[model samples]
Target chain A: MDEFYHLIDWALCLSGLIGLWFFFSRTGGPLNKAQAYMSVFREKGIYNPSYGLAIAFVYALLDIALSIVIYVWFYNDYWTDSDFGIAHLGRVILLYTIVLVSLHVFLPKIDNRHLRKTINTVDYHKMGLSMAAFVVVCVAVEYWLKRFVYGMWYGEESESILATVAVVASTAWIASSVYTSLNRYESIKNASERTLGALKTRHAPIVFLRSFVLDKPQRKGMTFDEYICSTFALNSQPIVSLSDPDDFLPTGGSIKIQSTDEEWESAINTLLMECRAVVIFEGKTVSLKTEMAKIQRFHIPHDKVFVATPPQNYRLAAWNDGKITERKYTLNYIWNDFVKALDTYGGMHGLPETDPGECMIFSFDKHWNCKAPVKKTGKDFLGYVVDQTVVHENDKCDYISLAEKLNRFELQHTQVLSKSDEKRIEKAIIKALIMSALMSLAVILLIKLLVK
Target chain B: MTPTDFQTIEESLGSLFFILVLIYYFTQLGRLRHRKKLDDTDGVKKVKKQMLWGIPVFIVLFFAMVLSSSLLL
Candidate 1:
């Protein structure tokens, strides 16, 4: 019993003495030395003291644990026989207190967040090597302290150690197995939900055209008027073409339909809501009644749709309350181009509303470049310059609509910057300075106490 | 035990320590490789940086022990 008390006292005394030595030694050493070493990797940046203290704590814990284990196994018997008392124990505890207090004060002020970030950007192999180095150093130091300064031994606990090793191995294996099983189950469940959701959203447009073949030919090849009528007959969608009554009227080519006033109103309303756009193919002479009336009924705004009505070269009388709508400019080639384009894309089986936006129109030309709007901004748009001047038809109007959608005001704002790094650096520097000063003070105090 | 015997024990212990460290290292490597998420480059760098200080301290202690018994005696 006496020997046991002696050993405890001796350990306490030795611990205190060592703690005092550590306090003094640090004061003489360079301050914020870790920050200097870290700076070599960075041009200029702050070092974080909290991060450094965390690392230091981990090392200290490992050191203390291994040292205690070694002492218990090898030095306990010898230690018991040594002569030590309460005064020694008190000194040891005091020394340790000062060291701890110093560390607490000094550890918060070093700044090195940028250096840490830079180091993190590197490859894994380099990182692994660095960690391995720390483990080696920690273990090696513990072994050395046990073998030399303490004259300790591992003793004959080989069997117990073997059992511990087995337990560790088994624990790791079990953890991995459980983790993998859980992950697989979660991923499979998520994938199933996604697939079901996608299926619910898929839809295809309804097609109404019926198949037919030309049977008997009356005049070998039908004239343009006859060709147009036959094509219209095959269209599945309900379409009514309004032609000029006075221009190029084939005497017997007129067709008639019978419908109630209510039916006509409902049809017009439905057409306005669903039909994307109308193609008004102009001719040599124009009758304004049926086409103009339909356009007004639909209330389809001018920008919402396009009229393939290229202005004629010659001035013609316009009837707005029976007077001519004053004419400004005329381009003959543009009118011919508009007529040709309408005949091509607007032939009879015009595509039903494919997407929500609008119906597209195009005309091919063998000569010079074509002008078309590429990007839309409200009323105006950026024109796509294909081959310096010729813009492709469908590609032109689509670009404008896309630009308008993208130009929403909220999307134009600049992004805010992050200040976490700067804040972190400032915190680290303050911590480091305080820690350094506290440690220095503690070390000076301890040295003074020891000599006394 | 005689100084010679102490040396033998120390040498054996040192070798055992080395072997233990090597095994632990290999185990860590296996763990990192087998991890579901691959090793993060930043984590590796951080570990390496810590080791720089940790390893040298360990090496000093290890060599000091080996020398203490034989030379200090």
Candidate 2:
């Protein structure tokens, strides 16, 4: 026991000496440059492989020395001749391993982005297993120290309980640490993505699907409802419906369908003055190409006049020049292609470019119930259009953007909300308070349980 | 060992854990300053994660040690 104390004293002295040496060396010379490089490496989120590895090595040695001191200090002060022998140390080690293993298994599953990054795949599995192994090794070493270096804890009951307490407390600390880390990671990740995504989306174009009627519906033509639905589906717009023309139609707009070619031509002229784009759907009896050619005599650009026909499956050569097979019509694929074609003319800024650093984002928040408006730079406007659907179809609330919601949050400082909004925020706060209270109670109970 | 012995151990451990926590917080402060200097967020999450784990562990251990000593007494 005396010899162990001397060893620990020597180890501590050595650590202090090294620390002091580094402090002075780095404060006044070439070592400062090395430190600056290390700091840069850390800042870039790059693991200074050599430095981290070195730190880990030093930590391992320091930890072992500390553990030996802990064991020796406990043995000399408390455990004499009793049942609390090396075997008791083994049980304590096992308990520590169990708790660590539980954290390893559970912490990663909590689903927080900050925590996820910190506990990356390699770290998660490796650290958990290594910790368990470390516990076992610590126990073995404690046992060896007690058995050979000092004949202690052969039958000490009090020391046994004390040992148990130490192990239990340490394990509890580790588990709690994991939980806390996971939560912090989540909040940080969410805040960062929300801020950046909002900034990016702010400058992007606001795209709206505009529809105008062409030749007034002939008696054989599809109803406005069916036509609009099919067109929207063909265009692959995220908008699900505009079935109620009352909801979308421009106020004071007149509607009339011409049955004759003479009436249709006049209707087309009138509709052209009133709207931006017109759709002409020709029934199977009409030759769409002939009618389209006549319209083109007016010399409108071909891109604005979108034409659709019934699909027919046929064989075509594959890209690899292998045998071709008949393929079915896919509205999803066709609409994507249509969007691509529109992008070429509108300048392809209509698609969301994949952001490498930005993480999975929920476009709306529960509290604000608002969708985020898209922001984009002029470069983004030239390059890609980001389109996002904020609210789920099944959700009852209307979409609100994050920027708008942030504005709403700011509003709370001034005027009071409506009775219903007040009630909603109040309910949320109450729920949060209740959850926090419950968690506190659970933690208290767990501490009590683990102590026993 | 008497209850007081356990109490002493608990108190010392509490202080030790606090010291460890303080060390960690100082390290984090340095890191945050460095990070803010560079205007970056990359891998900051990892450091935050470690602090999250480390800070609470000290707190829990401090209380646990106190409670265990009382129970033992």
Candidate 3:
């Protein structure tokens, strides 16, 4: 019986880990999954409070049924002989059902309000710390209730400490998972809002055209579009793209413009004229090729178009004939094939001879001459410029310098804030800090009093 | 060593392991921030992979420790 219990516990732990991995593997992770669920609910017009309550009640019943099955299958004999019996199990299940129902009914409403307020920004680290503090308070309360109210100590000191540790670890994991999802959802929503705002204001948003494969999450669990959005958040121009019809939930990178197959060409042509810049990531797709043709046909100013190439000579391992074989490929090789397809288009330049192991962005002059490849330098500041006059073996300029150069070309202008505007922002930030500190103090005080 | 002594050592090791896991979590968080600064996508990937394995291992070890302690008591 002990061995069976241990096996079941370990199995549960393993299954939980697998579930976590599965959730993380999704494009936007669990938050996007939740958003997709909410989207569906909204589409059916069943996103209201009454529907939420009904759904939660149904789910709670299902959960209780599953619990009963597990209990009957595994613990029927053991629990019957022990202090904990069927009645105890039933009581526990009933309590859990109530808690689960409450969570399902209320969590979305709380999350929606939280997202609305923190749409532009959310400090995930702060959220995690806050959750940890909340868990600590709950642990303290549990300890107090056991010792004073019930007048009984835990079975052993080591057991109590271990239980606390387990609780803290689980709570930390849950908090981090929730905050990560919230942050991703918030970023996507904010990007979409900004994109629409830019279009309405005629801000000439940056149009992103790339192969759908690039939308896949990389090792860092970030899509290429998400990376671009993060990298250029300060650029004052929105990054927008035509929505992938296949994507059920909008991935939070560029603002996705929904259009059918028939409308794609017209949309691209419109974007070409309206966009401040068109950035295309290196990919080999018929749709991408067609888009490139449209760019050429429109004769969009050469300086306004940019090509982003991934790191060269990236290695990938493949299992062949019961042996692992590694192969290396460069984006320049792919770029050459793409250039070949557009034989008559002279505006775009061919990739450089050298393969810079880092991702590089290239632009052309108004006269269709290939300018120097731009890569993000290790340095953060603009002053770390290497002399472009000296021809380096690996020719590249800093991405910051390239942005500044583009600014010079008046492709997109950065807004300068006035002294009054700066002061107003500073005052608002100070006020927010004081309010947050006071709120934290109040929460601590409340927890202390409750524990007492 | 006697059985009690062995149990004492095991409990101490379990406590030490718990503390070490906590430290590991903090260090991983720091490493993630550093990776973000460098825009080191590959490094970020490595850290995430470590975390995925690290978390499950910690949970398993923790459960084993708890089970042993509970049985001893």
For DockQ, the strongest prediction is: 3
Candidate closer to the true structure by DockQ (higher is better), 2 or 3: 3
Best candidate, TM-score-wise? 3
Lowest lDDT sum, 10 consecutive residues, model 3 chain A, at A317-326
The sequence of per-residue lDDT tens digits that candidate 1 reaches over residues A27-115 is 31112222222332133322222233333335334334434533444343424312212222333344344444444443333322210
Ranking by DockQ: 3, 2, 1
Over A1-452, each residue of candidate 2 has an lDDT whose tens digit, in order, gives 34544654565566556555545444322123223333433443322223322322233333344345434444454444442344333433333333223223322111111111112122333443444444445445644565556555344778756765665565444444333322333333332222211232122112112222221221112223223333232122221111111111111111212113223334333323222222322121122223333434454332233222211110111110111110221222223333343333322222322221111121223221213323322223111222222211122222234233323222111111246643543353244334433443344346435634
Per-residue error for A35 in candidate 2, Å, reads: 18
Best candidate, lDDT: 3
In model 3, state the lDDT of residue A305: 71
lDDT (Cα, tens digit) per residue for candidate 3, span A1-452: 34544655565566556545543444222223334334433443323222222333333334334434433443433333233333333433343334333333333221111112113344444543544354345445544543444333356898668866765675456446545533454445444343352232324456788766567443244555565455544333446676654342356656665555555677677666666677776665678888888887888777667666543222111101111111122233345555554333434655554433355666677666567777752221111111221122122223333223232222121122346644553353244334433443344346335634
Superposition TM-score, candidate 3 onto the true structure = 0.41
Q: Please list the residue runs of candidate 2 whose C-alpha ends up more than 4 Å from where it truly belongs after superposition.
A: A1-58, A62-124, A143-156, A168-452, B1-73
Which ranges of candidate 3 are over 4 A from the true structure?
Answer: A1-64, A76-168, A179-205, A212-240, A245-256, A274-276, A310-349, A352-358, A365-372, A377-452, B1-73
Candidate 1 structure quality by residue, lDDT tens digits, B1-73: 4766565556555655565455445434433332212223553454455556656766887888677746754
